[model samples]
Target: MSEKLTLHKYQSDITGLMIEHKAFGVFAEPGTGKTPTSLYVVNHFRQKTLVIAPIRIAYSVWPPETKKWSDFNNIKTGLLHGLDKEQRFLDDSIGIYIINPEGLVWLESMVAKHKRFPFTNLIVDESAKFKSPSSKRFKALKRVIGLFKRRYILAGNPMPNSYMDLWAQIFLLDRGERLGRTISAYRNRFFTRGGFRGYEYFLRPGAEEEIKDLIKDICIFIKATDHLDLPKLVINDIRFDLPKGLRKKYRVMEKQLFWDLDEGKILASSAAVANSKCQQIAQGFLFESLSDKQKYDKVTKKVYDLHNIKIELLEELVDELNGSPLLVGYWFRPDYDKLKKAFPKAVYFADSSKSEAVQIEKDWNAGKIPLLIGNIASISHGLNLQKAGNHVCFYTMVWNYDMYDQFIKRVLRQGNDNDRVFVHRIIANKTMEEAMIMSMQDKSAMSSGFLNAINLYREKIKEYDE
Candidate 1:
């Protein structure tokens, strides 16, 4: 911790506000240095702090922030994860316990055995992950939250999809005084149920204004673009309809849960698997696993590709990029394999060795890599790839709002002062792609959360069918 940490006015302001409350939240947007700012405030209290963050972030972000600056060194930090890391939990020498959000369920059981919880301060980074009150991790943390003297929550996109996300997150901080004491109480006060199964919830009129005002006292909101001279984030939504033949094939493949093909056929085991094929085909490719491995001397599993329009778009997008590095987020292995073949020099930031990862990061930041292809799950969290280039295109999208939000900020965050980040989404019209895009961007800010977005997406699926 040799370097000094200097906070921007807004960063210091947010920390000051959180410090004033026994329990608080900082809803600062990405690139505003929430890690250091929150840590700076945590350092003042001089007590052990428990940090629960995204798995990748827990592995990379907090521990480095603590070591990079001189003040952070005073706090002993330990990252807890995996069965092999059991020693970290029992080790009393560590003052700051940073654990993956998934690890909380296990930690809860372990710490429950002890007479007292180990840490005094509990900080949830990307607190939006716990927005669902019924989730195992949220319930686990809720059981032990009261044990902490100072509890802080942080997320730039805290309510990424809707203001309703504020409830569970804020509930952990202040016990729902600002939202409601119970999940039902909170939802009932602000939302009216409708849509499919009457389970869909929308905010009552004027709910947004009143809700923000209610929680303003304890939650500090910071928009980085407001405070920093960041280049603009330009999003280009490229919508294309599937070809008539492909569209007909898509409908048939979706309904029958099977595809008749050359030399072999593809079959889906269940409804969920069939639904996934719809998503895959919507993204321009469908994978067919041929069960006839015995034909190849039992050596390899064969796969077939049904269609590919995204690859054509990738070619055009690359030409448009004109040598500027591109970050492509795709969902499946075929997408990865296709992108790798299209751009021979492209680097993938996936499950690579530590040495290979180091070179990938270096080459990307230096602008030597033409394309960096990754799944939304692979290239997110505390990794600073913003220095690479600002041209990011989402070849496909998934359901989680948190992953969608964080993946975009990878190149739009702090170090990207020079480039105007362009986030291009190649969405297939009248398909699940549109539904995924709409749910993520839906302005039902007052009531939408992951569960709400999922319902909204499913409702859109029916609309597409109609």
Candidate 2:
């Protein structure tokens, strides 16, 4: 049996705030015990709760979390997913029903057919998924949200893309009380149309402060660094030059959007296409065909091998680790293919079945796997890999700052036993990879609005105490 779980001071404080407000946003960083904290709120309310989360998290994280903590023994949780989901819903002994965002459509139909909504409390985990007001799932939830007496939305970085992503998420919490009744109203009040063909919206001066103030009363934002003594994060950008011949081909592709290979001539029809091809080439391979219809499968496509500069460096880095478990992050199909070839013992996180994925996570945490590989998008959220090791290598850098940050936190989080976590980025010098890394940095800087709100709330609390 697991030991009794103890809440951190911040977790207890956040729980108090959530219970008081009833409708709230818990924008706490990953691995700071957000799941258990939310579970505490569920236990306190003793109401039937509906949790909408990412598919993997809906199935794997919540149900198991109840069993992991002794305090949660009274909270009976059921996963409303897969073919057995309908049957699971029939079991009324369950106090919490967990489903994915897309499942909301089916759930709405079920509620309509039954002429009743079973749940009185709603929790949307990774609530950023509902950022689009036009999304089918969001629309379905919006229709039925009035039935829930209490609501909560949870995310580490709620606004992953832009401030435009905030309206729908906040609307779910306050039903447009804080932002506006409609997205158009919110946009017209605080933003101006800009960018290509005026498709993008830029915030007006002081709009950010106004928006944050409107939502500050009901939102609780916590950073792990402020509350938890996690391991030191050391990021190293390992730079290298491509071979002379490969370098010439890369430049030709970047300049002309076309390159000649022995297998065939690779043509990039646009700058976006050329940029994508350049990234692949920098990672040591180039796909001969750029057809979107073609899917990556067991059979290898006609890919031309460019150079193994990153792979060779990875081998040296592994040797330097002297057998410590290494988690490698890959972006493209070719990157995974090359890494698996170079390290035959490496386990791919996404290639396994659901049952197999569970065992893989077990073996990984037990230090049974030396080199574990995964795409940033697959292993970025709600999956815990902190017990395995402290070293992470990015064979190719991801352009999205959220994915990159979440993947690194998989090891750098609260449970990590290491004194320092080392993140290695293998960059092909003077290539688009460098540009991507810088772009991610800029995006990271833009995501500080949530942290700013946290600071503002803390100051208000201090003033009240005085």
Top candidate, metric TM-score: 2
User: What lDDT is reached at residue 103 by model 1?
Assistant: 85
After TM-score superposition, what is the CA distance of residue 25 in candidate 1 from its true location, in Å? 0.8
Q: How would you encode candidate 1's per-residue C-alpha lDDT over 356-378 as one tens digit per residue?
A: 65567667889898888888877
Error of 2 at 215 (Å): 0.8
Deviating ranges (above 4 Å) for candidate 1: 112-116, 160-164, 236-244, 247-279, 287-304, 319-323, 340-345, 352-363, 366-368, 377-380, 397-402, 427-466
Candidate 2 has which clashing residue pairs, if any? none
How many pairs of residues in model 1 come into backbone collision? 1
* TM-scores of the models, in the order given: 0.79, 0.88
Which residues of candidate 2, in runs, are more than 4 Å off? 255-274, 290-302, 443-466
